[model samples]
Target: MSDIYLFYKPFHVLSQFTDERTDEESPRTTLAEYLKVPNIYPAGRLDYDSEGLLLLTDDGELQARITHPEYKLPKTYWVQVEGDITDEALTQLSTGVELKDGRTRPAKARRMDPPKVAERSTPVKPRKGKGTSWLELTIMEGRNRQVRRMTAHVGFPTLRLIRYAIGSWTLEGLKPGRWRQTTVHMPEQTQKVTLKPRKKGRGEHAGSKTTHKAHPKTAQPKSAHRTPRKPKGGR
Candidate 1:
């Protein structure tokens, strides 16, 4: 049986076991304080500055399956951007953007019309001639600071970011710093899962034994007796 948990992380909480005493204050809330289960680690991490749904699991294979890029799990975010957002900007975001590092993958984005979402506690800076707007975006890739960079590249510049969902899991009724154990059960026919072994070649053969044989009275090979050759003259 596998153990999986869904946690709603709040802003300013570090995604680590130990809190560092940096300029940013140490996290007052931690997974240990919330979750009583043992041996579970976060499937993926949410930045200390970001907030949303996070997954934890005691099964190492399940962790890799969720966090690894190959899974391409879709993550949804509600972002508030600075400046007036146009349909063109939304279209551009949906298509792709050329960031400083490289082009971002195609994403789904749409400008949210009123009734707009409630304002954030700390509102973004207001522009002189332009106004801020909200957007709903979904993307498959979770690159470092990806949503922020993508929005900035398209001239929106995300002011506030909140992840809403990861794959099938969501924050739902979970408030900040709260977590719940997920009870997932599958029938016998539905549980045919396989994991590749870590070793390779002959080493992977079942019941194969490897024994190291000691060489008796063995001399050095002929190549070891050759004299060192001089390098060709350089100009």
Candidate 2:
């Protein structure tokens, strides 16, 4: 069976295994720091600043199903905004918000009571007068910083975003930088096979039967942790 892992990614943590930047001295943390399990990789990306549930697997098909836009798996986030979110903003989010890239799909958005979340290491900047609010937002599509952009488009800039769930997976029982494994039965794909002639023994006939077998695809998840990297300047 292919390896499947569920990880709770913390803030400032990268979803990948290595930092792509060239500056060696610049401290950038990656999944490799926490995960010693080799060959597993993140199925999709989570931004350095965002924290929440991340799925890793060695199964390429499962990865494609989770990350590919065509599958449209629902991803839910617990978002904290700069101001009290309004009904109008909720409506816009539920109806679809116009972003620079394009209009986002209508999402599930509602004001939420303060969730029992662990305190962030780097606390969100305390707004002097403007109060902060929380919202539970679910979207079917994965766009680069889409949640942040959507919230900003509707006037409430997102200060903190935590992915609460993805499809059937959640961060339940998993802590930041920790992971667990499970076996899954993924739909098998049709495969084509080519035959190769079998080697003949000394007594075997000149003509020998050939055989071949289709290889099954499997997947696994790599190491992960919550380590937020500062987003460059402008939000």
In order of appearance, the predictions have TM-scores of: 0.70, 0.78
Candidate 1 ranges beyond 4 A from true positions: 21-29, 113-130, 185-235
What value of lDDT does candidate 1 attain over all alpha carbons?
0.63
lDDT by candidate, in order shown: 0.63, 0.72
Best by lDDT: 2
Model 2 TM-score relative to the real fold: 0.78
Give the alpha carbon lDDT tens digit for every residue of 117-210 in model 2. Answer: 8888899984799889999999998878999999999999999999988875676666677666665443345332222223222232223222
State the displacement of the C-alpha of residue 23, model 2, in Å, after optimal TM-score superposition: 1.9
Backbone clashes in model 1, listed as residue pairs: none
